[model samples]
Target: MDKISRLRGFRDIWKDELEKLRKIEEVARKYLNLLGFDELKVPILEKTELFVRSIGETTDIVQKEMFTFHDPSGDSVTLRPEATAGVVRAYIEASLFATQRITKLFTIGSMFRHERPQKGRFREFNQIDVEVFGSKGPLIDAELLWLISLILDELKVKNFEIEVNTVGCWECRKKFKEVFLSYIEKKLDHLCEDCKTRARRNPLRIFDCKKDECLFLTKDSPLLFENLCEECKIHFNKFLNYLIKFEVKVKHNERLVRGLDYYTKTVFEVKSSALGAQNAFIAGGRYDGLVKEMGGPDVPGIGFAIGLERLSLIVNTGNPKENLTVFIAFVDDKAREHLFRLVKQFVKSNIRVFYDPDSKSLKSQMRYAHALNADYAIIVGEEEIKNNIVSLRNMKTGEQKSYPNDLEYLIKDISYTK
Candidate 1:
């Protein structure tokens, strides 16, 4: 049989990378809790309709990137392209919106999308999604954006810009779409193939197109801000005022039409040149109509999702911790039994031990101890077992001590956190 290999776009995360992921998640959890947000977990696989309805059917995530297949029961299920839709599904089905005016919740897990994998993007990726439900005021939007800024600052990611835009409400968006479409119709041939297709379905997506030609053509197109309805204008201005008061540095970008169709009013993305021309560390906006669109109450929500893999790529933490309490070294098979008992005793007393039964020679075992950075190496031979004592060698200074069954106390004495 031929040896199997991983698919082209997928890459495995090794032990070190996994450790970094854990650290990032830990910090994110702490920050989310500090904001009074509770943790929530949703499944990876969900019914295809959830994404089709939440993320627009015309969007690339639904039209191309989703991993969808029929289940054994003949129901179509998709590996979730994003977690926001499913999180909303749970909120509706469980009636979470009925009671709480501001339910701050968050989730950290992997999201799947089928795209040409590149730096910071993958077939399998992880994100930290946070949503503040039932908050219609612009305060919630500013609060969420400011919180995201704090997280990036804490991570030491210095090179980033917050691009902000307002898509206006339903009434204003209707008129903007009319003028916007006609403005770009003359330059249809100049657009990339994908942008040309999206022009008919979603003209706003054309601005987000990465093609240099399309970018140049739409560089001076009509902005949504010019046609904001009375209510939307007030909301956008209020949100801006709050951001200023909160001291959040931001840039006014009229072209930021978030990929999701559900977003209305405010939309934004945190861009970084460090990740390349298409870099965005976090992206989110106000989805004022999504809750109701998903069969829930007429509640509005705003939130953001941070790219964990992208954040981990730039985090330069010094090497992962190196500390072990007991390193057991045995001379022969006869000493194995005694070594096993000592190992069990150490573990029972909540002491960390590192040992390999195959390692026998004192020199080889000492090398292993140094590699593991063990504080003390426990040497056991047939003679030591007969005397009910074990030789403990200090790996740091080459000092030796004999312990008569007080392994737990000795380990605690040396392994104090400085």
Candidate 2:
């Protein structure tokens, strides 16, 4: 018989890695709550059309990366490759904007994309999605950027930099795309196959290509920032001023156009040099037209998502604390049964314990406890069952004591030890 294996690019987080994920989640949760953001859990599968309409048909996600399939009922459905589109759909379906002029929301979940898996990029990955709806103020962009910096600083993720730029609104983008098209047309035969297709479809996507030939040809390409319309220029300028006021260290990269089509005004990415090949750990920008474009109320929104897999890969603090883990050993059927019954109480009370229910020998159980590096161990035997007490041992100090087999009493003892 052959064993089954997990699909390529999927992930199974365990032990210390899972601890890091939970820690990062709590860190984001704390700051988001302080900033007054509400939590949301949207479905993983949505209508395929939703992403295509929002993420742009020309983008790689919709074109070659989405895990799309027809549903049982024949409706085209897709596992979400990105979350903003689904979030906006929910925002519209719930009419959240109508009830409150300004709505803030944050979500943490897995996003599926069928791209070739890299170091921290997987087919199914988790993200911390943060978005604010219903205000066009530049400070909102600054605030989102500040939130990114705060989380990274708290995580002690070093050597990360924030790169920002503006691609202007559609009107200004149209003017600049023409200038880029003319420059690339002269060297069209020399460009990569992908960039040639990009030239015919969406010329601006040329800046997003990483092929060596494309990168060299576009090195002297026209910059969109220099050609932005007055309104977009002023909006971007105000966004820059607000970042300064917030004391954020940002580098202006004129070529930093994000992959999504809905972005306008200000766009940014929080990059870490420590992450090779895939450098960005967090990125997003202002999308003033997405809500309206997706058939929702006309409102402005800005948000960013942190790739937890990528962030956890680079952050230094990922070890799990063993002091919270307790081990329970038994030497008889009666004691084993009692321990099993007490297991429910420990679970309900948020205690983590390692237990062997087969009444293994004390020496063998103690060796297993040592392997787990448990902080405390409780020996259960006929004597313990007869007395209705527990023989608790502090694994670190080799101290043993007898205590009433009461959950509250054990909790009190544990708390005191802590």
Candidate 3:
């Protein structure tokens, strides 16, 4: 029979790659906790209508990317393509707004989509999603960008830029859409099929199209920044000033209307030059009306999502070396049981211990220890077992010490040395 294989666009992450992802999560959690954002874990599956209403029916996520199906009960459900919709649903259903005046939440999990896989993009991916509700000010917006900057800097990601723009609220988009639709209508014949469809439904999404023809045609088209209403213009400018206060350098991109339809007032993306065309490792913006639209109170919100796969590609996770590793080497079969008991003690004391279960020769066991890059080697023999003592050798320095066969003393000595 042929060997079973993982599905395309799905991968098994382990060793160094898994370590890098873990490091990213660690850094994200540290800062998120410091910022007072509580962690929330939402389900991987949600009602199909949750996304259609929040992400918008015209968006690609709703129209094409979602992994949706009718469950056994015959109700349509979807594996979340992104996290914000589910988070919002939880916020409303749980009535999180009744207590806290402002709520900050973060989640880390897998999301599924059906799009064609490419570099830094996948069908099943992981994201570190952050969201803030009940605050409509630009201060939170700038602070979120600052938080993102801190995470990238700590990860040692180099030459990444923060691109910012305003897609404007629904009222502001009304006027801009008229001018945008006119320009798109004339060039619909030359645009990609996707952009052509986007023009009739969500015209602003035309700017997000990656096709050369669409990009070239929309390059000189009307910009939403120019058409921003007085209120949106003021809000955007204040957001820029707040970003400056946070010392976050930002590039104003007039053409950046992120792939989501819920974004309004402020939109931004963190892109790395190292990742080529698919450079954005982080993307988000304000969705001030999403709460009200989802049948909740009129709460304002903003947040961002970090693509762990894309981020792992660019982050430098330094060395994968973990805690001290000790190898148990025994020369006699009788000593094996004693060493096995000692090994259990070391593990209980929170030490990383390794032992050969097959009673291999001492030389073979030593070689295995060296191969594992263990920090210390504990040698046991019938004589040492009789004496109630063991020989501990520093794998690095080759210095040996005799310690009484006491778990406490052994653990203390190892802890003190390393």
Candidate 4:
């Protein structure tokens, strides 16, 4: 039979890569917790209408990218293309806002989409999502950007830039859309087919097209900044002033309307040059109206999602060296049983221990320990067993010593040696 294979846009993540991501997650959790945001586990699947209402009907995500289908009972369900909608749904259904005036949530998990697979784009990918509710102050926006700066510094991701803009609220967005449509109406036939469709339905999305022709066509298109209402302009200006106080520099891109239709007021993206064309490692903005649209109370919200796959590429995710582990090798069945019992003791004391179960030759066992890059190798042989002692070899310095067979005592010895 042919070997089973993974579907397109999906692959397994092995140990070395997973270890790097795990370390990054640990650091992320620490800073997010320190910032007063609580971790939330949002489900992978949600009702279809939830997204249609929040992400918008004409957006590319809902029309083409979403992985949606009907179940046995024939209710439309979708694997989440992004996290914010599900997060908002949870915020409402669980009544999280009622308990606390402000809800700060962070989620790290898999997101699904049906986009073409490339270097960083995948059918199934992971994202670190952060959301804040009940606050619309421009200071909150600056603070979130500062949080992103901290995470990037901690991970040693040096080459990156923050691109920001404002899409305005419903009122100003409507006015801009009418103006944008007129500018592009005469030139629609020259744009990409997808942009042509978007021109008729949702013109703001034309700014997101990657085609050179489409980009040229929209080069002189109306800037949202020029059309911003007095209220939005003031809010955006105050946001920029706050960002300056935090020393978070940003490039003002008039065309930085994010892919999602829900964004309003402020939007930002973190891009890296390491990954070609698809370079955005993180993007998000304020979706002040999404809460009520998803059947929740009227509340302003803001959030961002970082793509871990792309992040792993640019960030210096070093391969961990297992320097604190020990490998135990036994010479006989009697020795195996005795050493196995001591393994539990090492674990209880928070020491890492591993053993070869086959009771292999001493020379072969030593090679296995070296492969693991162990700090010490504990050899249990008939002679050492008879003497109620064990031979310890330091893999690093090529030193050997005889210590009491008790792991509790050896734990202290190992600590002192370091």
lDDT of each: 0.85, 0.87, 0.90, 0.88
Measured on C-alpha atoms, candidate 2 has an lDDT of 0.87
Off by over 4 Å in 3: 210-216, 386-388, 400-403, 406-413
- Give lDDT tens digits, candidate 2, residues 84-196: 99889999999999799988999899999998998878999999998889998888888888888888889888899999998888789988888888888899999888878
Tens-digit per-residue lDDT, 1-418, candidate 4: 9999998898799887788788778888988999999998988988999888899887778999999999889999999999999889889999988998988999999999899999888999999999999998888898899999988889988889999999999999999999988899899889999998878877887897879999999888888899999989999999999999999989998788876778899999999999887899999999999898888899999999989989988867777755478889888777887875778877876668878867688788989989887899988889888898988889899898888887667788896654
Give the poorly placed runs of model 2, Cα more than 4 Å off: 209-216, 323-328, 332-354, 380-392, 399-415
The alpha-carbon lDDT assigned to residue 159 of candidate 3 equals: 83
* lDDT (Cα, tens digit) per residue for candidate 3, span 265-314: 99999998899778998999999989999999999999899999999999
Could you tell me how far off, in angstroms, the CA of residue 72 lies in candidate 1 after the best superposition? Answer: 0.4
Ten contiguous residues with the weakest lDDT in model 2? 316-325
Which scores greater on lDDT, model 1 or model 2? Answer: 2
Q: How close to the true structure is residue 385 of candidate 1, measured as C-alpha lDDT?
A: 78
How far residue 132's Cα lies from its native spot in candidate 2, in Å, is 2.0
In order of appearance, the predictions have TM-scores of 0.93, 0.90, 0.92, 0.92
Model 1: how far residue 326 lies from native, Å:
1.9
lDDT of 3: 0.90
As a TM-score, model 3 comes out at 0.92
lDDT by residue (tens digit), candidate 1, 195-225: 8888888888887787899999998988888
Q: Supply the global lDDT for candidate 4.
A: 0.88
- As for TM-score, the candidate ahead, 2 or 3, is 3
lDDT of 2 at 97: 91
